[model samples]
Target: MYRKMVLIRRFEEMAGKQYMQASIGGFCHLYIGQEAVAVGIISALRPDDYVMGTYREHGQILAVGSDPKAIMAELFGRETGISRGKGGSMHLFDRERNFMGGDGIVGGGLPIATGVGLAIRYRGGDQVCVCFFGDGAVNEGAFHEALNMAALWKLPVIFVCENNLYGMGTQVTRASAVPDLNRRVSGYGMESAHVDGMDLLAIRALSDDVVAECRAGRGPWFIEAKTYRYRGHSMADPATYRTKDEVEEWRVRDPISIYEKQLLGAGLITDEEIRGISAEIDAVVDESVKFAEESPFPQADALYDHVYASGE
Candidate 1:
């Protein structure tokens, strides 16, 4: 779990660098401080479980065990990308891994997640679908609709709201009539809870129970993970709306650092081992960049290939 968090942190850091260097084009959303939310929730899931996410989903895909090289290539618009470079950062998809792709639209994945749950029920499969979105998405009509449908049918879906307190520079208090997002689940008569997103172990323990319940035919749970993003909403965002002091306050409780301290305190891992892990992940991130840099762009002729279902 620690290693996964580090990998995502390092990967996002490098991705930010690549975006600034003009190597990675299109809208890039980095999941920096919110590593625990992805790692904790995903690490508890089975390999076959479906995982869906929002545009800021590099961390989620990584937690689902997609190759860093392919993801980096996608960001660079290379032909070897996970989505063949067409989806870029926002639309990463890995069917083999059951990562149902990231959506560019706010609350887009909610309805799809509901549909996935319905499919699971239809097929009589015990598989569960975990859909992740931001605090902003809760306001979308789709959010309410999807939750209502999932609850009505008792679908095996876990709706995870990664509440980072800002919907593109607007604070949650300013935007939401009721700032407590978990409470909104009451309207749909769905079970809900809150987790400290900075604490990975806590999130993982809660996820284990929730996922089991969902798989056991009691489902459509809502989890509001109280997380914070260290970076802006996207590469283009300056994030000047918030003061530096507020950012620093959250930084003091950084998910990675919090977990590192716990591990150290428990004597579960040594400082040397942590250093070794960091070095290894750093090399992996570096290699992903090299792969992206050396890879060729998608050819023009292949553009129309995946666009249509029929080979018209």
Candidate 2:
């Protein structure tokens, strides 16, 4: 579990540096410190289950087993990208992996996941849909509308709120009236839970029960994972809105460090194994960068290929 989270952290760290060096273009949101939330949630999902998420989705997409090469290529806007270079960093879609996409709009993925849930229920499939959004998105109209429909129709959907404190520059407390996200969903009469987003094992354990309930046709479930981001909203952000003391406070609870210690202390893994795994992932990430560099950009004529529906 910690292995996967470690991989995510490294990948994002590399991505942020790459963005600074102009290796990756367009919008790049790094899930640097929130690895536990993605690893814990995605580990609980089945291969056929759909995952919808916001722009800060590299970890979510990679955790669901998307090829790092293709994801990096997508960020580079290459023809070989997961979305064929049409969607860039904010729009990676893989139907085979059941990863719906990384939506640009803050709350966009919620409605998309709700619809996916409705379709799964209508088609009589056991597949559930997991939607990931930021604490900022909780105030969006789409959140309220999607939750209402999912609750009313009893759709098999897991709405995950990755509350990393700030929505761009505004703190969640400043934007949200209630601030208690789990309680916010209660008004829709939906089941909700709050998890320590830094605890990978705890998140995994809770996801097991929540996913079980959803798969058993128990309508919708909302999880508010309280975590923090090490980076600003994007590569361009200076992050002057928050204090160093606050960031340092959250760093003490860094998910990857916390989990690695537990795994080593409990004899689940040796320090040697951890180093080996780290080396392997670093090599893999290097390969992804190489592939993205070698991949060609999308041809101008092909620009309209995926963006526009043929019939439309």
Find the candidate with the highest lDDT and give its number: 1
lDDT of 2 by residue, 219-278 (tens): 699999999999999998989999999999999999988998998889999989999999
Q: State the lDDT at 83 in candidate 2.
A: 90
Query: Model 2: C-alpha RMSD to truth?
Result: 1.2
TM-score of each: 0.99, 0.97
Candidate 1 TM-score, C-alpha based: 0.99
lDDT of 1 by residue, 72-191 (tens): 999999999999998999999999999999999999999999999999999999999999999999889999899999999999999999999999989888888988876778888889
Best by TM-score: 1
Model 1 / residue 124 / CA error / Å: 1.1
TM-score between candidate 2 and the true structure: 0.97
Give the total clashing residue pairs for model 1.
Answer: 0
